[model samples]
Target: MTTATAIVAGHGLALRRSLPLPNPPGRPTTVSLSARSLPHARRRTIVPVSPSPRRPCRCRSISSESSTAASAASDTVEEDAEPAETYDEDEDEELDPQAEVCYLDPDADPEAIREWELDFCSRPILDARGKKVWELVVCDATLSLQFTRYFPNNAINSVTLRDALASVPEALGVPLPDRVRFFRSQMQTIITRACGELGLKAVPSRRCVSLLLWLDERYEAVYSRHPGFQAGTRPLLALDNPFPTTLPENLVGDKWAFVQLPFSAVREEVESLERRYAFGAGLDLDLLGFELDDSTLVPGVAVESSRAKPLAAWMNGLEICAMEVDTGRGSLILSAGVSTRYIYSGYEKTPAATQEAEAWEAAKKACGGLHFLAIQENLNSDGCVGFWLLLDLPPPPV
Candidate 1:
């Protein structure tokens, strides 16, 4: 399988030609060896590097179902007829005096704090009672504030977890976060209950980048040093992912193509997208420590959907995780949230698909496992309703 790389001049993209590239049957080819010969080319700015780090992408156009229910419930509450009087108290009285909090960035502004990533689960260490030790780790998105506490397995519960969460604000002088995100779907029941008791919105998502990185560091530096640390124990229990399911019949696209764009072009165009609804992880290469050049090609899938708005809205509710080419199944798999897997499309059993998949994977690896999913009205659409920049980071060291 011969492959050739061609530059798309004004558009700021590099096309890698693998024979019979991943495109729907009978669609006009979007990639060409000569950029000047391509139809409808557009110009874009090329930035060597972004000045300030891009913010993490969030679905902001619509609130989740859980949040809507919470909002409705709050509306029924009545205000007090009389205002309560304040009482003077000693300033020295400490809240959870025993709690020890660690700040990743001591100078991080409290006003900037909004969301928190939390992990409450059993560690690889045992207590004197020979029971597994449980831990509660919390951090903001910016790696500014981190709080960790350990508990015995027997004492781990929603009540204990709530108290630990409450103590964070008192210990760090930061306000309670509006929302808390966790990656473990298995711990959903307890984590959700604990957050609910304190009126904090709980989100189950795979976007806990900072927390995962912190866990990796702690596994090597803190947990390993414990006298009761169990060697060879996995940091996180492995959960079986559901088999890949098909996308909804109504949401399937009319056509799709595998494409690549320069990092600068992606940043410029995605940010300037003119659409009624758009959501995705913004460019945050700096946070991930990726050092690719502006011209580096980033692979992505472009879907032309007549029902683009509805499809994008539905996907916004999910934690869009990663994409993979499953050679054994001969399918393109989209992994979302914790364990939900979807068969985005299937590939022919021919060598072209294998070659294209290899090239896509190679490009993703070169760009630090970063790729994108774009949903637009058509191939000629100026903007997409949804453009997710996803990172397929490796699981933290077990």
Candidate 2:
């Protein structure tokens, strides 16, 4: 029997079914921002009092004084022009440190399975050819249900799922509380234990499951319970060997678990991560030598890589030394620690260009923008020092 649940998506936020089962899909919800109202009075300019105009001088006498006053004003102008001390209210704007900004595209057609790459800091598997392979992991609601039923006693009870969701007060409406929270606390334990035995991380369950639900267009009833989990469709595989101790076997089902990943896609994701972190963030890419590059140069993007160029060219362009990785059933993620030498040392290091960049950085900082300032210290060694000049903005008016 399938329990009822609704998938809710919003402009900046998307939520999984808040109500576990037997709940109706409600209206589209929005995260509200409080607005502050300013006072209605108009600002008045302060004028200097003119000493009662020296007993109201006549027009002829005032004309004579005007010439003398003009000379005095000229003398004061030089002193006043010494840079006014104006306050910058914009200096306090803050950066949103949040990782992902998400929204549900209700128009999301489950029938259309969009493909994305999962990155990893390290290889998750080895193919039959003895080649190291990456994995792209995703969050699977069905998988969650599988683990939910697989170990119902230890997992978050279905009743708690319902209550937590129901706790979302009408004022701050969303179908469920943050689904990620559920995964981190309740679902994560079961998944990690299950997949960890198979040497995979559990975070990809969301991305993987969301991908399937969106592409398949199956209803909540299809996934509300855990019984049908054994029949989950197998993902396309290009590897010659089966995953280690992951396949379900009657002899020892508890000893093993399995996750599906596409090898080519994994390679692509790792390559992309390498290029992105290396070029933009100065991430070291040494450990990512295994990932093959698939980038081709477009006209406007000056740095060009040919289809035939070795993948290492991308890494060479940016002096990356290593990467941090997380891998799982259907996902592979790679976080590169970029080399400082490449980040600071672009193709050209002319004096004029350096000065211009410094000035631009200063201006950007003043305007509350991202300032990529260069450190004068030597960056040849591994430990290079750098700092970020970020904007500091006040919280949105409540």
Candidate 3:
């Protein structure tokens, strides 16, 4: 048996290296990011690829000013610039605050600190006054920093949430997160407003894997042992995922294909080139505690469109949750941001499409629901407008 070590590099590209199996598969040796160096870790030089001369229509930068005229003019000039260079420049502006804070504390590495995951909802326990107790739980993606506080149900509002969030930096001795992710849709309005007031991007996403795991642990180990704990209470947070909606007419892909890449190829071919828009930092298999063989197949879907840049930008704004084959609807469904869903493509009764979908589902299952989605101008294109490594996690227990 052989295992692979996964590393998330430059702007969330997933990189891996095959290693001789030391421990049993699925039991990964704990590797700390704080370590100065690992004997097994090797550096790979990134050979920059020049932007294609025949560039597709560019998408307006999402981080830029809102004026349409200004955005259009900027997009025209950016068409000739390297996508990676443009992204790096924008990112530096966003990280200036974090960088400044890290300078004051040499021990704190801003790159190693993941976004904060927060949950503010009613708990299964009650206070002495007979009022239901609500709790706020905050934890970083790595689960290294945590803050928990309880309040009466009546006190659950934006003001209370805001004050609690404001204290997180000092309480946990970490810089404010660029974004805060919460899984509950019912609390979206309050959470969004609270984060907005504090200049934090509040994302409604099911990608709060670390926070969910912590909540489950506390439910069984801490909540259940409390005297005020209510027995057999319903789950605190449940999302009513709606049916898949059709993709916007203009954004629909002209061609699509089911694809697969081995772990070795992902590290070699995919990681070598920088992507225009990439989002996979939260889906690291090693951080999520999975160790698989280098030959493991990573199933995915490729979409091609003339408006590849715009399509990629639109998808990047959404918290990409998962992609699945909806056999009943005969369509490929993409789940994103809280309970939002989109029909990626329709297979109908086509034999070839159905078979390909089946193969993709099988391969994805074999790899523990790990897959990706790539947006490119065409199948033969060397560069991708967007690439996302997504995980299809099981629904929360009722």
Best by lDDT: 1
For candidate 3, lDDT tens digit of each residue in 1-398? 22222322111223332232222122233211110111111333333333222221111121111111111112121132122113344433343211101111233464566578889887778779886778888876655566778788888899999999898777656678889999888899999999999999998888887676566545544565566877666655666579877676655665555555555444443453354344333353433433444545566777777878887778787888788877665667888888889876554334433444565565566555667777777656765677777776543322
> What's the best-to-worst order under lDDT?
1, 3, 2
Top-down TM-score ranking: 1, 3, 2
Alpha-carbon RMSD, candidate 2: 31.0
Model 2 global lDDT (CA atoms, 0 to 1): 0.20
Give the per-residue lDDT digits (tens) of candidate 1, residues 326-398: 8676667888877788877665556645655666666665565667887777756666778787776545443
Candidate 2 wrong stretches, greater than 4 Å: 1-105, 111-301, 305-309, 312-350, 359-398
lDDT against the true structure, per candidate, is 0.62, 0.20, 0.58
1-398, model 2: which lDDT tens digit per residue? 11111111111111221211111122122111111111112222222222122211101111111111111111211231111112123421221211111222333333332222121111212335443322212222222111110112223343433332233223222232122311122234443444444333334211121232222211111221223222222222211111222111111100100111122222222234434322222211121111112211000001111221232233233222211111111111111111121111111223332332333223222222211211111211211122111121111000
Better of 1 and 3 by TM-score: 1
Q: What's each prediction's TM-score?
A: 0.74, 0.19, 0.67
State which candidate has the highest TM-score.
Answer: 1
The Cα error of candidate 2 at residue 55, in Å, is 70
**Which 10 consecutive positions of candidate 2 have the poorest summed lDDT?**
251-260
**Deviating ranges (above 4 Å) for candidate 1:** 1-101, 104-106, 269-277
Residue pairs in clash, model 3: none
